[model samples]
Target: MQPMALWKRVLILLVCLWGIAAAMPNLFYAKVEAHNDAVAAIEAAGGTATAEQEAARAEWPDFLPSALVNLGLDLRGGAHLLAEVQVEDVYKSRLDALWPEVRDAMRDLRDQVGAVRRAPSPDGILRVTISNPDGMTAALEAVRALGSSVVTLTGVGQSTLEVTAEGNDIVVQLSEAEKQATDDRTIQQSLEIIRRRVDEVGTREPTIQRQGEDRVLIQVPGIGSASELKALIGTTAKLTFNAVVSRTNDAGADPGPRNLILPSMNEDGVYYIVEATPVVSGEELVDAQPAFDQNNRPAVNFRFDTTGARKFGDYTAANIGAPFAIVLDNEVISAPVIQSHIPGGSGIITGSFSVEESTQLAVLLRAGALPAEMRFLEERTIGPELGADSIDAGRIAALVAMGAVGLFMIASYGLYGTFAVIALMVNMALIFGIMSAIGGTLTLPGIGGIVLTIGMAVDANVLVFERIREELRSQKNPFRAVEIGYERAMSAIVDANVTTMISAATLFILGAGPVRGFAVTLGIGVVTSVFTALLVTRAIIEIWFRISRPKSIVV
Candidate 1:
């Protein structure tokens, strides 16, 4: 056989060496992980590493690729929560907000509509009664004018609100298109907020995804329990600044029209009557951090965005000595009197909170509030012991498969079979290297993929070796037989691997979770196996033949 090109051989060698280097860090996972963490800590602190951290960093060389394949939740253990967003709650808030607008609009045409009064209605519905029943058509037209087009791709040209007149009552509710849009926004915002919350705790690769229209699925690896995960994300954190009109200890106090009575967070049973319209919403907050109050108590310091800052500065300037309620999730956190004209839109919130609670509140503020409340429908905690057992089982299965394959290959075709076995090992290394490079997660099914790949890795080699035996029978020349064998078997090897790769790709696109993990390993294995079988084994055989200069080769 003709020798391989020098550049081609060098390229192949370099690739193999790179794969080996990339895969090396997994052998010392804990040490490499510590080095990476130390580097991150030093960068975050803007300072030098400690002596222990320095030692840890030195355990892994900086020049080589140090990425390791992330382990999946099934392998690492974690908390899982399936939550459903209360999207209808947003509708109620939306209608409540619209009351002021509707009332103002009706007031403008008081002569035509007569007296306008807000009538109690179910959630998501707004009912306004007019004294004159004959003028309901004109009133409906005026209210309908308030309906704006829904701002969504599927809701283009559709009104955000529906207006109808029943006798003297004008009924208002969100349009179907608007409801769909709101649901979409709620789920997306919930997912993002959950992600931010989980990421704040420095958990690795926590999965927070929208399950359906109103449901979210959260899986946080390394969390102690589902309850812990819930505690982190369950709070609505709906912080708002409302102007306080009166203070009361009565739970059933009447705050009059367009006002609400909310219970205090620190003082039990004490409530405050505040305006429904917020001066600044939590959505306007740009940043928040855990801080200490002047009294040395834990607190959360927050800064608002430009618009919010201007609005807050103007409001405080106009209402000095007036109390404004800091509300969170319908509860009054505090009703502090504005002592002076506060500017710059930065403030500290002090309540009866512990250090941990303050820190969590700060995290929530930074992440922003969930659009609406979420009800956790399902919760689960997977123990680390179960994950460890799964890892052990998968590891044992893979090792046993590798050993059996290696032994079978060696017994079947002698030195040539040993070459195939070596190529198989290289194939495994390349698979892991690629996975590590891409930050792929390894699930239990992924280990099964690797084991299956071990058995299949040598199929191309076996085909070539069998063809070589046939050629040897006909030609009786080792060099010519090897060349002809590889050439003739190339088409079959390519066809087999390509078909399998297509299957793996389909699995990846159509599957989720463990199936996706299986697809990833399988797809990677197919590519690496083909490379090792065609290049590595051939290189080994050609080199052996060149050194031995055999006249005839054994089958």
Candidate 2:
């Protein structure tokens, strides 16, 4: 047998050691995972670990890699939601924003388009009537001038607003280009918000992705139910600072056309009429935390970005002794009088809130509000019992496959087959090690893929063994036969595994969820199996041959 170079021998030994070390955490999965979670919690809290947490952290050594294979929804059990975003909700907001611009532009053409009055129209349409009918064309031009070009690749050169004249009235709505762009932004923002909310709860491996233009798909493992997940993400949290016009006890009060009446969250009979335009938006908020007020009541403390701080400072400075409403999702959370200038852009929101409510509110504010409301179209909760049963079944199947494969290999070729069996064990370890290293998730189908890989892993060894038997019959020398066997089988092994890898790549690219999980395990298995079969097995055989110095070998 030809001896391997010192560097190659060391490299092979190091790889084997790494695979063993990386795969060791799985032996004590619960303890290791608890340790990792405790460390993460302590870090997130920006403090030292508690006694219990420190004990948990000490359970696993810091010198060793603690990453374990992430379990997929099928194995971990969690909540799944398919939510559809209300993208049209932004249209009215956009048009309302355009009102100020439209009014200003028409003010420039006051001589041509007489007095322009805003007439209430449908949800997405903004209607303005000019007293002079002959000046309708000029009014259309003035409104169209307020529109800017759409910034999208497909929408370049197209105007964001669609303006048309019906009789003496000028109608405005978002153009198709603008609507599409808005939908994309809304879905993306929704996905980000959902991710933040989920991550805040410290869940492992939550998948939040955009499904379509107006839909999002969320899968959170280890969560209690779909309703709980929904509660975390469903709140619009649309916080705004609107100028308070008046506070009334009567619910039927209509404040003017440019203002809005919102019901009080705390008081049943109180309502506030506020200006439609918000001085500062929650989107400008950078940080929020749960804190106790001076009166020892639960409250959410918030800090704003530079732009918001300036706007808020200016508004507060100008409106001392006047009331301003903090609006959340069209409901007036509180309407407080601006007693003094709040220049630092830091404030507390006080209401009849519990500690839990304050914490949830802070989390929502920090996560940023969803751009639009989400209606859950589909919801599901997977129980942990089902996942446990699946894991048990997969574990039993793997054990059975390993036993059968080992017995067959050992019975066929004795010492050499034992070497192949050992290589096979290393191959499986390396598969799991790589998966854990890469933070790949393991699902039910992923277990099936692993089992399938176990059966296929020995194919290269089988080819080499068969080739060795043929060479032995012709050459009559054990060392020469082994050399020729490996050389002859390399091409076939490479071709077969490469083709299978291509198939796994296709599955990973086009498949979703469980199918992709299976593809990941399968692909990793192929690469590891090839390495173990060719290098690891050959190294073991060479070492054995050198030690034994066998003149003749039995096949």
The prediction achieving the highest lDDT against the true structure is 2
User: Against the true structure, whose TM-score is highest?
Assistant: 2
TM-score for each model: 0.87, 0.90
**Candidate 2 on 1-555: residue-level lDDT in tens?**
567798998999899989988988987888899899899979977977789999999989988889899888888899999999998888988898888888898898898889989998998899988899888887888889888999899999999999998888899999999999888887888888888988887776777888866889998888899999999999989899999999999788888888898999999999999998999999999999999999999999999999999999999999999998999889999999999999999999999999899999999999999888899999999998998899999999998998899899889988888999999999988988898898888999999999999988888899999999999989659998998899999999999999999999999998878889899999999999899988999999999898989998976
Give the distance in Å from residue 512's predicted Cα in candidate 2 to where it truly belongs.
2.2
For residues 46-128, could you state the per-residue lDDT of candidate 1 as single tens digits?
Answer: 77779988888888888878898888889989999999899999999899889889999888888889999999899999999
Alpha carbon lDDT at 241, candidate 2: 93
Q: Estimate the overall C-alpha local distance difference test score of candidate 1.
A: 0.89
lDDT of 2 at 177: 96
For residue 259, model 1's alpha carbon misses the true position, in angstroms, by: 2.6
